[model samples]
Target: MGAKLSGGGGSKFHVEANSEINVTPFVDVMLVLLIIFMVAAPLATVSVEVKLPPAIAKPIANPPKPVYISLQKSGNVYVGNELSSLDTLGDDLKKAIGARNPDEERIFIRCDKGTRYAEFMKVMNKLQDNGFYSVALQGEDDAK
Candidate 1:
């Protein structure tokens, strides 16, 4: 007549912890972001259309030497190898322009690589204000 076994079924329910992360949602979110960027990438680029004049390759007979305006790294301005100050640049440039047809005159601006953009722009603005529209910027030729 020993102890009576407790009634009922012997089935036991065990609870297990899940440590694995669910990456399905994370992958879905990433794919959505990728698609959004792909759709917007091309729209973000901007382009400008310019109407340029027709080009004619011809050598001029006895072409006039272009006027050179050089800007040094130290912000000094030179008008044709002569050191000129900004205040007097207008008068000097005027005299130079007076010597030739303003319509046919082309002024070339040369600036040292180390020169500040603002300094270079000031020279351009001054020339433009003085009615010098045929201005050209001089750049070093690329070594092939």
Candidate 2:
């Protein structure tokens, strides 16, 4: 056979750049990372046994129903929803508080925003005159 300088139809054989991405390796790497994280996740959260001391404190009793005093913008006073004038406020408060010690029981005061400071002080004076020293001011909760 005669020596050929180049292979026949060599121009027909050409190399082209592959535009498609090879995702098999990427999928393999991701699967390996997933397995690694799965294996390491449980080991990361190791809990230790804690020895706590015995609780010796006495159980607390149920709290008493709170007593509320409402002062209206109309200058009317209320003791636990019962309408009362400032003249009878002390007696009404005592009756509302029942046999509970006035010195220890807390009396909550809620008032209309339009109520005057003088009117509020009048209710306070009535409570103080009745020997009820534990008075708490009630306000609307803003958390809601």
Candidate 3:
């Protein structure tokens, strides 16, 4: 068979352009990310060692009982042992605080793990609006 010649008396070869994707660079980037995360995972979590004072070392005479507000997973709000609604929570809290100074009295909020964040915030807002600023969140001890 004789090869076809172009106008300049030289044979020209036509090459088709490759359309396949190159995944080597993508794989290299993924490996780099994996290594970075592996090195950073241990450093991401850090804990502080604390020495707590003995509970029986010092006892105060008639310590005031702290007010407890709990939010359940079912959207139920509790002011101490009494069930309360969101709409009337502010008024109920005001009555609970009574003559005690809001700044001095500590109000602890215990939220269920399954409770919505919005519901927790709503309880906090209600307490803040009612002049209870010394709010604390109560969490279970991790050791247990």
Best by TM-score: 2
Ranking of models by TM-score = 2, 3, 1
lDDT of prediction 3: 0.83
Per-residue alpha-carbon lDDT of candidate 3 for residues 1-144, written as tens digits (9 for 90 to 100): 233333443336643445667788899999999999999999988578789877876666896788899889999999898899999997777678788777788899999999999989888888778777888899999895
Residue 7 alpha-carbon offset, candidate 1, angstroms? 99
Q: Go through the candidates in order and give the C-alpha RMSD of each one to the true structure.
A: 14.6, 10.0, 14.7
Per-candidate TM-scores read: 0.54, 0.59, 0.55
lDDT of 3 at 135: 85
Superior candidate under TM-score, 1 versus 3: 3
What ranges in model 2 sit over 4 Å off? 1-58
Tens-place lDDT digits, model 2, residues 74-126: 98888887999989988888888788888899989999999999999988888
Give lDDT tens digits, candidate 1, residues 41-134.
9998867778889889787689777788999999999999888988888778767666777666899999999999999889988887777789
Task: Give, for candidate 1, the lowest lDDT window spanning 10 residues.
Answer: 1-10
lDDT of each: 0.83, 0.86, 0.83
Pairs of colliding residues, candidate 1: none
Candidate 1 runs further than 4 Å off: 1-61
